[model samples]
Target: MIKSGETNSRSFPGITISTDLVITGGGLSGVCCAITAARQGMKVVLVQDRPVLGGNSSSEVRLWILGATSHMGNNNRWAREGGLVDEILVENTWRNPEGNPVIFDMVLLDKVKKEPNITLLLNTAVYAVEKKDAATIRSLKAFCSQNQKEYILTAPLFCDASGDGVVGFLSGAAFRMGAESRDEFDEKFAPSATYGELLGHTLYFYSKDTGKPVTFIPPEFALKDITKIPRFKTFNAKDFGCRLWWVEYGGRLDTVHDTEEIKWELWKVIYGVWDYIKNSGNFPEADTLTLEWVGAIPGKRESRRFEGDYIMRQQDIIEQRTHEDAVAFGGWSVDLHPADGVFSEKPGCNQWHSKGIYQVPYRSLYSRNISNLFLAGRIISASHVAFASTRVMATAAYVSQAVGVAAAICKEERLLPADIIHEGYIGALQQRLLKTGQYIPGLVLEDKQDLVQLATIAASSELVLTGFPGKPLLKPLTLSVAQMLPLPEGAVAPVVFHAEATADTTLQLELRISSKPGNYTPDVTLATRTIPLHPGRNCITLQFDAVLEKAGYAFITFIKNPLVALHFTEKRVTGILSVFNSVNKAVSNYGKQTPPEDIGMEAFEFWCPQRRPEGHNIDLKYQQGIRLFQAESIRNGTDRPAGQPNAWVADWNDPQPALTLTWQQPQLISYIDLVMDTDFDHPMESVLMSHPESVMPFCIRHYRIKDAAGNVLAEKRNNYQTHNRLEFATPVTTDTLIIEVEHPSEQVPAALFAVRCY
Candidate 1:
């Protein structure tokens, strides 16, 4: 090394990089977008301001990612966001089921690192943007402090997944920072000025209990009197991290510019609460509790949301409106917080749940005036009311995945972001996304090029479910529980429930289904029965006189009666599971969401399933066996459970479960895509929760593919992802294809959602 002659003025070393797509943000939205685009054959540059990936979900902030199936706290059954986001979450569970935030960082970093087409620049902040025209972005100027270098990133397409929407803001894209008035969009659920115009930044602290006594002393700036917080009594040494999510601030100030001030205030609140719990003589049990870790930065909820062609409003979410260009879905409630944040005299949030998941149209994902700019995450084109729901991490990632796929098409078609919609290529965009396991509500994969659609599909055995044989486990009816089963479009089947009552009690049972088809709300009650129980084990027959208008998942609900205990079975089927009328306040589930009359939200019961190792199917015998699981379901084009199971589940008794597809003539087959069952109903939370199993029991872990010549093509030992894609090194001409699968356990049968060979 040689000493340099210092000049009057010097600049950092500069480099110019060109990529197909420039994703500004390293959060889940940006990460998923980058991965999706890179996988689709685009050179992607992912710029992040932080040291690590996963904006709010990263270890710096440590907020667990959640979307539809809102913590399994809503009625969105089988509603997990699919595609690369699902892959990331499923992998996180397998690697870090214990919810170590640092482990989660490893998962994201590892995924991005694996993508060869991606260029990830960590600690790179994009401060300035260059415009090609008044309506397009030309390039972005970013600086990396750690490397002491400057980067000029140029791309045809630009995506603003940045939480603060730096690119969108700098590019002069139309954006709204504050809440819209109720009369503007006719959004009745719009937040009143006193309620709050914006959701604020949140910080979290982790605590641990030592076997020996421990103590904590507050810093000089630490809040001495926790009484300043309205909800001071709610804070305890036992709850930390995301469990203390309500501890927020900075809504009243400029969220973008005053973030540092907000961080200080949040720090003041966190330390104050810790001081109150440790030093206040409230409880001697706090002697062993210690602050393990505290977040240095804050997790932001709202900033400047960019504008696109269509601004989704209140009715769009609550009414579950459909869009022709629907590319993604969001089911999280229309959740809004107060401006006063932690110091508010009101409840922390005024959350309102929809009856079902709402679609995010392609029209709302791109800048309306800016021709080449695409929006993602908290900055997407949505009204203040709609953003409350779509602002969630999983949903944001799902929306960005659509953007990624769209960007690939844009680059290939020589088009801008809005051209796909105006040129009537939205269907192509949706179909392409569906091929990659992205779930667009009401959309099904219809690939004419798939070879399996032409083959004569036949399975050795299909599940003809009569009912699960009862196990010895007796669960008390302390909470309302239901057995969810898909029925035919005919008379309701009679079910026999084996239960015992310690004391005499009346068991009230109701048969309910969603008001709309393809929805699992259980809002419409078809019939009700009140049965008297004796003080011993008894067989109760619930014969509903209801006739179905259409086939859908029906709920057999047993109202909570503490005196009665029902038998539950260990037998797990792919499409069948049980739901409980539960309350998980973490995601705003309160048994039932009851809102004021004019708030635009209806009161609906939450029928959610318990996590694995706990969600045993209720043992109920059906007089007529349900024969919906057929071998032909493999080529049906749908991946997950819809109005029907949309999957082919093998019979439990079948020792060698296999499916064979025969073609009249030999065909060249080189690629295979199999959609495995991963318990889509179960929300694989990124952190703060422990999953019962690493791999979904319903997934076919061990599987082999063979040709008619009896030569094995491929064999997988431990498959966990929902979408298993295999591309052979060479094409094989085969007249028939055979798929043999092994169940993970005796309880769960091997099931395949869709298998496509081309």
Candidate 2:
């Protein structure tokens, strides 16, 4: 190779690329959007400024992704975001149970690389936008610093997922940089100037013990004094990384334009905190610890929020209001951080949780004025109060998945984003998202192409919920514990709880359900019973004498009794879980959420399930068997547990549980999608959190499908994913199909949410 001296200021190489969709940002939102669009047969160009994907979740920032499950802190039962986000999370759990940030990066890269239709541009920043007209985007001019090349990306559709609204800003899309006044949206949760209008940026660091004493020298730039950070005393030797999410600042500054300044401040803070630990004589444990990693960039929280047809407000989240164009859902509390961050003497954050998961409308996904422009990630159309709940990585990803599918619909139909609703394609969009395993609150998949619906189905042994068999394991009722039971709308059955008490005491039993159907929060109490407990083991009968008016989950709550120890079973069912009214400090849940009276937030007790190997079902006996799990339940279309446990669970004793579908005529089938359980209640954070198990305990590990002649159609083993889509090498024509599932483990029973044959 020969090198030539540059004459004048020669331009770097430039190229033009055209695609069906252009998604700006390599964060989870854009990554998921590109993946979804690529899977839907759209050519997608994904642009990122960072070398890696995942943005805040990348190894550079190292923030663990969290969303609706809220670390399983709030009362959101089976509330994990579905679709590609769920797939990514499940894959991460399987591949990197250790939650290594680098491994997580590989997972996102692997997913993007496997999609043939997605052209990912790493280290590319979109600097300019070309508009076809005042309302539509024509193309984006982006430059890749690594290759020193400029790219002109053209697409009919443009989705701006860049965390700070880079594309939207360049396109002149309507946006707001700070919080709106309370009068703007009539939002009571609107923060005052003192509390802060925007959440701040956070920097994280990791420390590891070297087994031998290590010394650290601080730079002159490091903060010399330790007391500068009011919360510095709360720091421990083991606490590191995003666990120090409160190590934040710069909300009072321009979050986008002043990002460099914010990052520098964070760097100074990081080194200062490290220096304090090493030399301040407070942490002796730091003698053997060394900084393994410090974030290269600060994880940004709030910034520019764009405008759409509908701006998500505080009421939509707290009231769980339905949206006609509802395409997504979120359950995380309205979490806002202080503007002063770690420097402020106030608490790090103010959070207000809703009663249940609420729907997100498609109207809020596209720029109101920019016809072809889509808003996603933290930049989506939402008021300050609403953005807090929607800003999390997974929630943003889930919403972006909708944008991806909307792009596909738009491309195929030659329609604009608003036409998705105006032209009556919204239902089609929702159904398409559901086909991809995305769950929208209060919506069920009604696909006419699903052949399983037309077939007559019978199960080998459907679970009649008489009760879980007793185990030797006994858990103290130190806090209120409840068994979540699926019930019918008719006469209620009495239940018996076996318990041992250190002293004779009275046990208070209450039956509760959510006020609204399809919500798991036990906000409405239906019945109560007082039972006597003896010093020795006692079989207490709780006769509620209550009759339900509608079918839903019933919480048989055992009030806190320190003297009583109730039996818990190892038997795990797909949709059934035992919940405790307790605190998960990680998410700042302290049993009950009693927010300030004027915030327009509801107060409710958080009855959340524990993670696997720990969340066992309560051992109890049903006076009358409840047949909620029938073969017909699978065809109802609702996959995950909504207000009800939308699953057909096999009996615990059924050794060879199978569902056989017999059709009147033989039909050819090309593909089949089976929806299994992966413990949607578990958050499955992609980084920094070590899960109890790689595969969800409720996931069916082995399953087989057979045709009329008993020929094996397909067999899956060690399967941990929630969606199992199987395409045949050749079309299989059969009048009868049988699916047999093996229990995931000895503790968990086999369960199926839905079966679709196309």
Candidate 3:
């Protein structure tokens, strides 16, 4: 009915189009892939079978976008997914704090639409694939039911982000469905024997209070008795949205072929459950509640996992293995659910947490059989045990960004996906990703375009003893408050404290070591220091003669003094904490508590209870100029290494911090790239918790460049965002270059990730 063409044509019944990259499935992963590729100047076709984007995260399914943070539970600290995914989370937080699914849809749609090189094809399903050979795909045939038209799209590269691995399935890419035997991948957590069963699918519903009584009429398909359901005992009428992930089915059957049947079964369960809550006389609270929204499409958990060059195993995650070609990282626990889903009598799911974050290699992103086929989302190469953690939407989105960036590099270099590593292009891809704000653990950006790298580092002042201060010094306490400080295992060193007094006062400090880090009070007092404080700021030093046998907390406390106050800041560090206690109680046991009036109940708690903040470091070091030179920042790269600080911090007092470069011989430069810190300490998550700053206030708001003679070379004012690349109209030859930066706010230190010149 249609003739083949290069662009959309109405002459034929069907439409034909072409692009450099064809991304199937409009889920978070696919959307990120398309955006990343398009932003890099590649023409991209983003095809989604549904009317909207966000896949499970859309209003249709309403699943929260969870990544490494894992709902802020477990011990996965500071593990939020960065890059394009962070942008979406931040924008959603700013626009929709109530976690409204409708607004989230707009955020994703707006992001894709803003890309000039991206051609969005919503409600278009790619059903057929045209393969050039056994390893290459030539084109794809997609049918858009909404428009009642078919589209034949051709592209050099294809990414199958479809949750079901539809593209890879049609292309005959080798893939595994369901679980694999433990012997297959030597994964200890995997089942002893292989099974065709999968995690399952789920449908969610939202309910709201109408203020007045509401009646519910059951449909013919709804179940009459709720007693048949095993989970009814735990069900509550108030549970809705993602809180009801337990209402699931279809794990025992084919997730794709049996989708309709699964949806019908889930529908019955949802209505039946609603009926029980409304008319069953069991829940009186539901009389004033009504159903607001329900999902028509089931949110699938597992389907076909395509085969790639490397198959990620559970050991890689549990052991925290690092790969040389790792492109992304994931920290979600290995969460596996029974194939029987909600029907099973056992607990819904089992979770195994990792020691920390784990790495995902690039080799696991592209197909091993279909050379030209790239995969993202839950379909990426991983054993079933490993997929449990990587299958999360946020992790999938991060993977998609990696694939998108790699695809752009492939197109630019005229190479295949596998050839990227073979030809040493992986570094370039990593650098580009870092510059674009994709955080790859253990990797650093080494940009050469930064002219500041040649400059001698100097600063007006440097805060050498910089650490997290738990909370601001707002109120003075007459009672002593003990704080817990975690220390590395080994011989203990003298701890220092920075304090100030309005008048001369006697201060007594004690260091007590606790065997358990969670203990609210220490059992043994290892050392003590009694010093007379001066009126102005003073540094008190305490020495401990004991050695810590293991990594534990050193409970330090300053005796009650109403006239003296300890300086504190709101800035939070990862492992430090400010502890608080009940004024009249002493902690009898570690985390256990006695009655409120009990005098022996010692409770050391966070400065702001249930909140996270940094500890105040008494030994603050001050230096003149930036701590690290421009060369260190540019050469070290922008990827913030885990457990290590990679950013160059300037003096907080320097109103106009600047970096200058001077050379004996003049050099020609035209391009300048700058990477600034965007408050990595704040974890960017979906809806419930979002960072307040879309653009960190500490970043340079205004800046200008000049030559040795003080002639303005280029200037930019009202700057925002973390990454900035400026191009000069003409190359300038100069022996000296000075970069002046105006802070967005006074007293806040400037943090530079990298600055490069070319």
Candidate 4:
């Protein structure tokens, strides 16, 4: 046990504890950071000021968990923040579909608590720090308001994930506050001149109907005149909780120091808004509604951003620049809110999107002045314009995961945060991250330690026939539209699609190949087929003897037939393309409240009314719309990519598919990691929708591994895990390893993503 005032002077009364890593803040980023480090065998001490784990996502503040996927509304197709963030999302989606903030807090708390090496201190605020030298933080002093006790935590490495970067500030680390001038970083999105204004803070409230008429009495602190607020016109009393994100304030003042003042102002606005809803004769529907909950603490957006080796700028996000030392990626648009926030006359914010997702380098995650101080979340080095995109809770969680993994490597090698970037350790770090399911765009997992990469791969079935059990079109299209299906350069089989009809109908299907590369529009009709469809599902086969000269899209257009309903999958396929030619000017409300912005400007016009791009392979799902096959899934190292399908599938007739890895020479290996495809049909955001099962039925249920001599090395029967790691008690030396996969009794083909050995 740590004795009181042992490490520090008697003036500082606290229990002194030593750990390898010390993390401040219990937000999503901090929680993920501590969990990642602890899981990697590092002793972690997590100090969170709030009792709950999630900061903005906590019930205290009540913000939904959003990341790079942007609710799957943006054009950063198939982009989702992976690793720990994905884990939390998947778990939360399965456990709490209501999107309850209290359940989300438990999910985060449970994840951190499961790590044996993590010591979580809740309601503990880090107020003081001791410096080992000019460049290193030696220890931190925190006081837990809940327990009325103090703690002195000494660590070799320190991570400041605090939204306000309190640790870095107290440690005298170089930092910047507020916006920078456009000339400073050459950022076009930056303000014309420097300003101290920030993105402001938000307070949310939840309301419910009380069955009978409910009366609301206004508090004395509430604002009297609601007409002063410009956004008051958009206010609908029926919209409660997070839907009122525009109920924000304090961007014109200091976001951190002036938090109390901001909170008071926000309270006045919230109460006034509620009063208008209850007392105003305009809202008759609110007569039976009562305020269920209102947040006291405001969810802050920006404050003190620390200075690091590399300062991310708006150009990097706009250009979608790739960095050599990229450890994480962000796909959210350059979402910059006006300084006036709710009071602004203009729209709440202006968003500029990139062509695709952008990379975040390791150089921007460590303090420039304080060598041992690693930064995560909003504290990372970035100009205000760049921070606008990376400030979301999900993006911050990804950043923290990277920092946690990097910190583990640093502790293992006894190196500082900067050494990982300069000493050529980034490649290893990236590889490790990939193995853990973190998707870094453009960075393929090519670990030299992976024995499968050294081997010549052969499968029981090499030819992947397209258009089997085609994706079901949730919303059938009646207009004469074409769907683009990506065919591999070398073609071996014809495409088939399954469709249904309300009545006996005849439809004409035309297959058109692209005239130019990267173009999905049909240029010339290669083949045409006129077929009659039945009432229920029927497989329509089109036999076209044509070899795709290059990797391009095949546009399949179906003539308008009111009785015929074509099938398609919401899950996007890597090379599949979908487009529709419709003159209907009716706007599409494809689940998202806002339009696709500039990201989907063109694609929206092509596939308007439905909004989703056409290109997903035509594959029929199981009884309840469960996807069964994924192409190009093997060797990708990731099973799912947001709403995209990413697993390889075999011909359903191929009962026992064997994936063989034959190396040139016999190698000693002790560990193997295997990842399989779980259906991506289930939506991650299932607040209004719920899925029956978390694991897809198409997952491999049974598998066995054997050596060249046909000796059974290891086997798993009746397995349901998507990710399986096998560790041999003793090293196995073999030139050839065979992994024979058995499909479940459901008749689905086996799908695998990665076969890694170490």
| 380-428 per-residue lDDT for model 3 (tens digits) | 9999999988999999999999999999999999988888888999888
lDDT per residue, candidate 4, 355-429, as tens digits? 457889989999998999999998899999899888988888898899999999999999999999889899989
Which structure is stronger by TM-score: 1 or 4? 1
Q: Which digits, one per residue and each the tens of the lDDT, describe model 1 over residues 1-758?
A: 98989689988999999999999999999999999999999999999999999999999999888999888888898999999889999999888889999999999999999999999999999999999889989999999989999999999999999989999999999999999999999898988888879889999999888878887889889988788898998877688888888898999999999999999999998888888998898968888888899999999999898999999999989999999999999999998999899999999887899989989999999999889999988899999999999999999999999999999999999999999988988999999999999988898989999999899999989999988754557999989999999999989988988889998878999999999887888999999999999899989888999999999899999999989999999889988879999999877788998889998888888889988789888988987998889988887778899888999998888999999999999999999999999989888888887788888888889899999888999888888888898889999899999999987787788899999988
lDDT of each: 0.91, 0.90, 0.73, 0.73
Q: What is the TM-score of each candidate against the true structure?
A: 0.98, 0.99, 0.78, 0.80
Order candidates by TM-score, high to low: 2, 1, 4, 3
Error of 4 at 520 (Å): 12
Please report how far candidate 1 places residue 744 from its true position, in Å. 1.6
**Can you tell me which runs of candidate 2 are displaced by over 4 Å?**
none
| Model 3 regions lying over 4 Å from their true place | 1-12, 192-196, 280-285, 466-493, 497-568, 572-635, 657-672, 681-683, 688-720, 726-748
- Stretches off by above 4 angstroms in model 4 are 1-13, 192-196, 454-463, 470-486, 489-633, 636-646, 654-671, 678-722, 726-749
* lDDT value, candidate 2, whole model: 0.90
The digit string of per-residue lDDT tens for model 2 on 127-220 reads 9999999998999999999999999999999999998998889888999988889899999989899888878999999999999999999888
